[model samples]
Target chain A: MRFYESKTAPASKGDLTPMIDMTFQLIAFFMLLVNFTDAEQDQRVRLPESILAVPPDEPYEERLTIQLASKDVIIFAGSEFSSLDQLSRALLVEKQILEAREKKVSDTTIIIRADRESKTGKVQEIIQACQTLEFLKFALRGKQAEVRVRSPSN
Target chain B: MRIRHAGREDTTELQMTPMIDIVFQLLVFFVMTFRIALPEGDFSIQMPSASASATLEPQTSPTLQVRLKARADGELTSITLDGTSMSDFTDLQQRIRRIVRDSAGPGESGSDREVEIDCDYHLKYDYVIQAITAISGYVDPETRTPHKLIERIRFAPLQK
Candidate 1:
């Protein structure tokens, strides 16, 4: 009888309000800090560092991002092209799309995210491909370095 | 009557299971999608097509050419600014500063000064960027402000 009485007693419930409040705070914190602009950054290319590589005051009106993963591979719009001929064809399609929208092809900035180890000639070739398409503005992207590159007088 | 009061109080207890489940799911979703991005910047340059460049009239100031020599293994060997050999990128920056200071009088901007980067075929792209960084500008260590050196930058024809 004693065992039955002890087993039938109501269980204790501690306060859950504080835990719920803390979890809600954590959720709010994470929601405020989440970013979705990292889609353009690829893991294959490690950009060269430059102290003078400061973000532009105003973002370009229209921009196309092209990444060079290796000497033989170029990534544009998540598609890989091995040769300049293929890349040129892709760029032509993009130009046609821009023209269809009544947009000036020259106004679109080409952002080159070439690997630090890639060949310079390959980058120039990429530029030549864009040039052939009448895209004039080129923005060479680089990782920001914190080191001080002071002037000679200093 | 006492048992009825106790049952009424039990019925008033909050239902927290569903709310907690949804909150945890949201937290997990955010945690899974969180990404830390490194700050990046650009060096903007405008280059016209070869045919267009040929038709354009020559400027009053000559385009200063900086040549980068590289080894078979794709390492930078030497830097030359307008046919004058430079020991390193720092030296190149000094020479450019002197030229800009002398050419541009008081309150004149360096926009008219142009620089052309001529890189070897097999050179690593990083060295070319280093050259561009040195030619474009320098950051003041004291104020962390970037001072512009040359605004106009163009790449030379690719060397075979």
Candidate 2:
């Protein structure tokens, strides 16, 4: 009779510790997975498909990456170089400094990563700037094509 | 006197305000920084469909690869070919022709030579077609016939 009376008594409190822990876990998962998209988003550009489109063997060295956005050419190389002429001069100065220090200029490769909608002239400007600076080695970056699959019903 | 004497009860409380504030701040930070994945422009390029067989054979020597950037105002800008910029289109064409003519076999002429063009993905279809037409004149074998026997035309995606 005493055991039955104790079991029938109402619970004292609601345990919210589990709920709080679960919420924190969910927040942490989202925090780890978030990837920030930038202003130079290539939304309208459509790329050519290629079977040979493979990822780099390993991560490439940090090189100059120029992005041709709609209105402006964004030069992303640790610091942003807005003017083409200025960028060219800067590159030239860097080359000269490197040559003086090492007795030979390093083949610092330039990577052009342009948006599809960006004007070709802008991309050319970047190339011309690099050439003026004597930074000859260049790599045009591209994304691999996705394989499309048809529904089983079709 | 005995009833007045009493023992004190122990009390404990967990301060969750600071922890909740930190969690909320983290949530906001993630929400602001979260970027939606997008397909790059090069991957979505619509290559002209053709029935030609895929050629896996490598070319004997490196050839100048030209990429033309067409402006919205109908201006054409030439970019680097494999990263090396040419002086100008006219200069580039003349140099290519001379190189091809000089490097050809005894029987082969300028007509048998070929050059590859990787047009910007954003360039208008008409501009590319026009550029190809213009380039054909520079490579024509004979003065009378303007037909350029271009060895191949390959659509290369713009690198991101």
Candidate 3:
């Protein structure tokens, strides 16, 4: 019997060090640069799109995030508040926290990240609630650059 | 330990089983949880509070109200600028520019102007953004300047 009639040379071991090193680098990249999204923004909510949207300028100084999930459902910091009144109370607590750090809550640039499906007036009511609480400065958030939208005046 | 024959294929090898397993697991986790879209903009608007009413100089600068009336399906049916119905966004822009030109100086464009957006109860946010883009003048590619038809924009009381 010719069990090992036509035999090739024994194979050398392949080095996995390079593969492991490259994999680790990729993992590190995702870990460091991946979006660690804020608690105020729920990824499930589809945001509205706008070509005019741009990041807020500093010296508007302290900022607060208020998410309007629906007309009744709102969230700020970490707690979900059902009513605008409740949301403002939570905002008040946050203002105190900021004031403890010598920051002015009044100077805060409030970002309203309402869902695309939510009514505009729901967002407006949240603004009214914030306004009633004296947190008057506001900003509306939208998904930026969906189109290279040509503005009428641009 | 058994000695290998010289020039025979050195059997010693890097065991990649564990490393591949861990790497694949990490890849799966990030791939599933990765968020593609990011919130990149905070278009600023301000409301004049009763306490800080004096600093806004409302008397010096008239507030232009942009009214957006929407249908039950949350689409805008009409856009009116201070009771005058605008034909389209272009007309809206022209009227706003004229408003700014009348009050604003060469260097003081829209400094003294204020804009109030009166949105209906059921309007979708898309139309609001469209309205904002229309009234909030475009960026001047010429001088790389952001031309402001009005710097101060506030939402008016929501009408049912």
Candidate 4:
């Protein structure tokens, strides 16, 4: 009997260089756009739009973000308060903390993020509460509106 | 002549499994953590407490008061600038621009112009912002540059 030799070709491998290159490009894009800072933007509050609402030249050194959700709910420091009294109490405590840290409560800006549908009075109440706590500086947050050029005739 | 192979060809295989796995992991992590942050800005208002304001002497420039009225459903019903009814925020802006231009002194930049917003309790917050936007500044129609009408804005005392 004669012995026959068997021949087998090596399995083909798809090119991974292009895929790897594309993936690396994607990674770089995301890395460049990734924001690591706490934006203090809560999903519950939809900020009103303003064309003049430009970002500050420099970020405030110390700031407190108070979000006013719809239906009079105030979110501060990750906690939700449904009433002005509760929020005031929390702000009083915040004032004490700032004082303990040797930080001027007046120097710390109070940023108000109020939902579009939320009552204007609630925003005023939050500001009043902050004022009571000696937070004189208040920043009303609004999303930057898309620029639409108006005709001089109009 | 005797055949002598001085050097033999060596095929070295690189281990790609570990590197590919790590790269995939990093991609997945970034994809999961990716979030698009919206561009936000602030309208800063420096308001002292009522008591503090009381201590300071009254100002020479008259305060421009804007009153916003809303219906039961929290929609803007009407807007009034210094007791004068405004058709809309556009009208308010025009009137403000005229006032600022007329009252501006030679050296004055109109930054001293102040507007007080008095809004109804049930009014939607959107209208307040619109009023503020109208009262605070306006973009030049031809140049597209923003011009300040009033830099100082404060809300009126909270009403029940």
* Every model's TM-score: 0.88, 0.50, 0.77, 0.89
Per-residue alpha-carbon lDDT of candidate 3 for residues A1-154, written as tens digits (9 for 90 to 100): 6586787879987777888888888788777656765445676556777666776656456778888775547878877888877887887787788889987767888888888878898888888777776787888887776444356785
Q: State residue B130's C-alpha deviation in candidate 3, in Å.
A: 1.6
Q: Give the TM-score of chain A, superposed on the true chain A, for all candidates in the order listed.
A: 0.84, 0.57, 0.77, 0.85
Q: Is candidate 2 or candidate 3 better by TM-score?
A: 3
lDDT tens readout by residue for model 4, A34-130: 7768556788889899998889999998999999988788999889988889889888999999999999998999989999999998888889888
Model 3 spans with C-alpha error above 4 angstroms: A1-12, A37-39, A70-72, A146-154, B1-29, B102-111, B139-146
Name the 10 consecutive residues with the lowest summed lDDT in model 3 chain B: B102-111
Give every collision pair in model 3: none
In candidate 4, which residue pairs clash?
none
Give the runs in model 4 whose Cα sits over 4 Å from its true position.
A1-6, A151-154, B1-12, B102-108
DockQ leader = 4
lDDT rank, highest first?
A: 1, 4, 3, 2
lDDT of candidate 2 over A52-118, digit per residue (tens): 2334455444345555555554645434556777667667766777667663332555655655445
DockQ-sorted candidate list, best first: 4, 1, 3, 2
User: iRMS of candidate 1, one decimal?
Assistant: 1.9
lDDT of every model, 2 decimals: 0.87, 0.50, 0.75, 0.86
User: B27-112 in candidate 2: lDDT tens per residue?
Assistant: 77777766665433221111222222234345576655667765555456665555677656456545555555543333333344
- Considering the two chains of model 1, state its CAPRI-style docking category: medium
